[model samples]
Target: MNRISATRSELLARRAGIRLAIQGRDLLKEKRTALMREFDRLSADAVAAMQDLEEKARRARASLSEAVALEGPEAVGSAALAARNEIGVRLTAKSVAGVKIVDLEHDPVGRARTDRGYSLAATSPRIDTAAEGFETVVEVLLDFVAVELSLRRLAEEITRTTRRVNALEHVVVPRLEKERDFILNVLNERELENRVRLMRARSRTDERARQTGGLAERSPA
Candidate 1:
């Protein structure tokens, strides 16, 4: 610890620092509270999205199984090969509580039977059912991932803010208070010492005056 001067100036400066530290702690506390609220709200949505994603995946798998049974593995494989298309994903960004949130934007996944790239007459309708179910699953999966990412960012921000608040409250403000108290005590002691010295000096001066008066009184005439 750097020892501060035993003066009023250092005491005032320490007091100012203490006030700023307290204000900073309060602001960070507010930020933490806001982050928690947002996280709670999005966490609920994330749970529902996860459940929906699981259900969609299960249904998609069942439909694929039926398609394979009804239309032979070779035929289904041929259709899958023809219908395989690269999915385009468009991503955008937004901010919430000083955190970056990623948004998933894309075209609708469902398509008409004619649009599936396979000859409608050759492919069983079961293939289309399976394809549609899986596409829906993909869409929901995207939504679920987006929510999970947001929650993660919020959690991180909350942690950082909490740390900052703790540092100010536990470390910074207390240190300043200690320094201020030290300065105050030193100044008080110095003032007391000066007063004692002044009293001794006055006493000596009064004694010299009394001695001179006694000599004058004892002198002849």
Candidate 2:
């Protein structure tokens, strides 16, 4: 432990530092609270989205299986290849309670049969139904993915902010306070020592003056 100077200047500096640390701690606490709120809200949303995605996925798989059984696997695969489209996504950054996360944008899926790139005459109704189900599943999955990613980012930030708050509360402020108290004690000790020395010096001076007056009295006038 490094010893701080036992001076008024050092004391003032330490006090100021303590105040700043307190302010920092308060701000971080507020930030942590806000982050937790956001995380909780996002978590609920992500859970719902996940549930929706799962249901849609089950439906899509069932439709695809039925299509395969009716029209054969080779026929469905050919239809999928014929109906493929170039999927694109646009991602942007957004902040929630000081945490930056990604915002996703994409074109709506589950298009009409005319838009699926496969011809209605060439493909069976089962293939079209299967394609629609799968497209809906993809749409729900994208939404779920975005929510999950945001939740993860928010959780990480909350953890980081909480750690900082803990450090200030448990470590930094207490140490500075201890140092300030140490300085105060040292200054008080020095003041007491100085007072004692001054009192002793004054007593000696008075005794010597009295002795000199007594010697003068004994001499002839």
Q: Once superposed on the true structure, which residue ranges of model 2 sit more than 4 Å away at CA?
A: 210-221
Q: Candidate 2 lDDT, tens digit per residue, 1-221?
A: 35567899999999999999999999998988888888888888888888888898898899999999999998899889988886688888777777877778888887888998877887888998899999988888877778788888888888899899989999999999999999989999999999999999999999999999999999997
Q: 171, model 2: CA deviation in Å? A: 1.7
Tell me the tens digit of each residue's lDDT in model 1 across 84-157: 77677787878766778778877777778887799899987899999899889988987787788889989999
Using lDDT as the measure, the top candidate is: 1
Question: Model 1 reaches what TM-score against the true structure?
Answer: 0.89
Please report how far candidate 1 places residue 27 from its true position, in Å: 0.9
- Give the per-residue Cα lDDT of candidate 2 at 209: 94
Off by more than 4 A, model 1: 212-221
